[model samples]
Target chain A: SQTIHQWPATLVQPVGSPLSLECTVEGTSNPNLYWYRQAAGRGLQLLFYSVGIGQISSEVPQNLSASRPQDRQFILSSKKLLLSDSGFYLCAWSVLGGLETQYFGPGTRLLVL
Target chain B: AQTVTQSQPEMSVQEAETVTLSCTYDTSENNYYLFWYKQPPSRQMILVIRQEAYKQQNATENRFSVNFQKAAKSFSLKISDSQLGDTAMYFCALASGTYKYIFGTGTRLKVLA
Candidate 1:
């Protein structure tokens, strides 16, 4: 079975601080990875997605960026966090080259103060 | 461009009762996929059910099932014998063959004891 892992499960970052959230998947290779953000009581907003290493597509333009440094390893980063950047960040992975179901990680809750 | 719409922002139902959450999408492509995801209080995104555009039969998983109307562009989720554990934010999503998914704003389902 495939599983996705994300950390730090919860984060508290001061305004203007750097941000880094990591996601890794096991039991699958060359999977499609995605980053999404959800507000307090709102729908998910897609931030970025990667089909392969070094290839990323941004769904929305904002303070965040994503990178697929290795197959099955994806990272969401920001040079400086904004108050608006605080939310529940989710990482998901799906099978490659197909319309397979996406599996989500536990998620990272970032609180910016 | 593909878009998903969950008309209900919030819904409530008595435990053991059945509740249907409505969802509709817009897409120009004939071959695609639709999915329903549940975000529990634990904040983990769990795949509840999935429907392929090419298939006429609806998708079902245990107590959860989807009413997929391709011509109507509607894919509503019905939860039978709802439980408190079923309380969560349910999101509808559309994915084309290109591997890109567009999510609906989501509906908050509250199952009262």
Candidate 2:
């Protein structure tokens, strides 16, 4: 079975600090990767997605950016974090060209103070 | 452009009962996909059900089912014999000619024992 993993299950960052969240999928090849954010009691906002290595399509323009350094490894980064950048960060994956279902990781909770 | 709407902000149901969560979407594309995702207190996004715009038959998974009205652009999730484990925030999403999904504001469901 395929599984998605994310690092730093919980994070606390000060304002204006750097941010890096990692996501990787095991047991799948050529999978589509995505990054999403959800504020408390709010819906998810798509930040970025990658169809392949070194190819990323951003959905929202904000303080975050994404990069696919490897086939199954995706990274979401921010040079300087903002107070509004705090939320639940989710990483998801699906089969290449498979839009029917998306598998998500455990997620990272970032609290900016 | 695509948009998903979930009017219910919160709901509660007793265990062993049936509950339906409503979802509506707007899109110009004829061929697309709709999905329902569950986010538990753990904050992991889990795929509950999926429906293809071209499919007329409703999709069912165990105690979970969907009433997919393609022409009406409505997809509702029905949870039968609901259990306490079903307590979570449910999100409706749409994907149309895009690499990412557009999500609706979540409906928090609490299945009481």
Candidate 3:
């Protein structure tokens, strides 16, 4: 079965600090990866998505950026985090072709103080 | 670009009763997909049900089912015999061939004991 793993399940970062969240998927190869953020009591906001290694697409312009360093490894990073960057970040993976079902990771909750 | 809309911001239902959450979407693509994702208190995004644009039959998973009206661009979720465990933030999402997903603002459903 396919599974996604994300780390620093919970994070507390000071304002103006850097940020890095990692997501890795197992049991699948060449999967499309996505990054999403959700505010309190709000729906998900797509930040970035990648179709393959070194290929990334930004859905919204924000303080965050995404990179696909490997086939199943995706990373969300920021050089300078803002207070508005605080939220629950989710990483999802889906198979190529016609499959639209996305499997999400446990997620990382970041609080920028 | 596609957009999803969840008309109900919040909904409540007595346990063992049925509740329907409304979702509408706008898209110009012929082939696409719609999904209902449940985010429990644990904050994990779980796939409840999925409907393909080409299929006329609605998708069902145990107590969860969808009423997919392609022409009307409406996909509503009906939860039968709701339980407290069903309380969560439900998101309606639309995905086209672009490999990107557009999500609604989401609806919070609470099942009263």
Candidate 4:
């Protein structure tokens, strides 16, 4: 079975601080990883997606960035966080083609104060 | 580029009753995919059902089913015998070769006793 894991289930950080959220998938290789943010428990805004290591695509221009350092490891980072950056971050994975079922991680809730 | 639209912002139904959430999409690609995802209070995103553009039969999973009309570009989710557990934020997503997903704003559904 495939499992996606995300860390710092809940986070509270002051403004201007650095942000780092990690996501990893087990039981699958060369999966398409994605980063999404949900604000106020509403819609999801896709942040980044990677088809392979060192490849990243951003859907929205904002204070966040993503990197795929390994085949199954994806990281979302920011040098300086903004108040608008506070939201629930989710990691997802799909097969190579990207047009397939997506499995989601537990997610990380970040509160920037 | 593709766009998904969920017309209902919020809806409530009496437990054991039925409810339908509307979703429509716009796409030029011949091969694409559609998905209905549920975000419960726990905040975990779960895939409820999926439909393929090439398939003529609508997809169904237990109590959840989709009314997929490709020509109409409508994919509505119907929940039968709704239960309290059905309360959640529902998202409709469209995906294709781009390796990216265009998600709808979402429809919040609440099952009342």
Q: Rank the candidates by DockQ, best first.
A: 1, 2, 4, 3
**What TM-scores does chain A show, candidate by candidate in order?**
0.97, 0.98, 0.97, 0.98
Summarize candidate 1's per-residue lDDT along B1-113 as a digit string, tens digits. 68898889999999999999999999998789999999999999999999999999889999999898888999999999999999999999998867678889899999999
- Fnat, one value per model: 0.87, 0.79, 0.59, 0.74
On DockQ, the candidate that comes out on top is 1
Residue B58 local lDDT, model 4: 98
User: What tens-digit string does per-residue lDDT give for candidate 2 at B2-62?
Assistant: 8899999999999999999999999998788999999988999999988888889998999
- Cα lDDT of model 1 by residue, A1-113, tens digit: 89999999999999999999999999998999999899998888878989999999998888888999999999999999999999999999998866888889999999999
lDDT of each: 0.93, 0.92, 0.93, 0.93
Alpha-carbon TM-score of each model against the true structure: 0.96, 0.97, 0.96, 0.97
Interface RMSD of 2: 1.2
Candidate 1 runs further than 4 Å off: none
- Ranked by TM-score, the better of candidates 1 and 2 is 2
Question: Whole-model lDDT for model 2 versus the true structure?
Answer: 0.92
Summarize candidate 4's per-residue lDDT along B1-113 as a digit string, tens digits.
58899989999999999999999999999999999999998898999999999999999999999999999999999999999999999999998767888889999999999
Interface RMSD of 3: 1.5
Q: Model 2 off-target regions past 4 Å?
A: none
Model 3: per-residue Cα lDDT over B1-113, one tens digit each: 57899989999999999999999999999999999999999898999999999999999999999999999999999999999999999999998878778889989999999
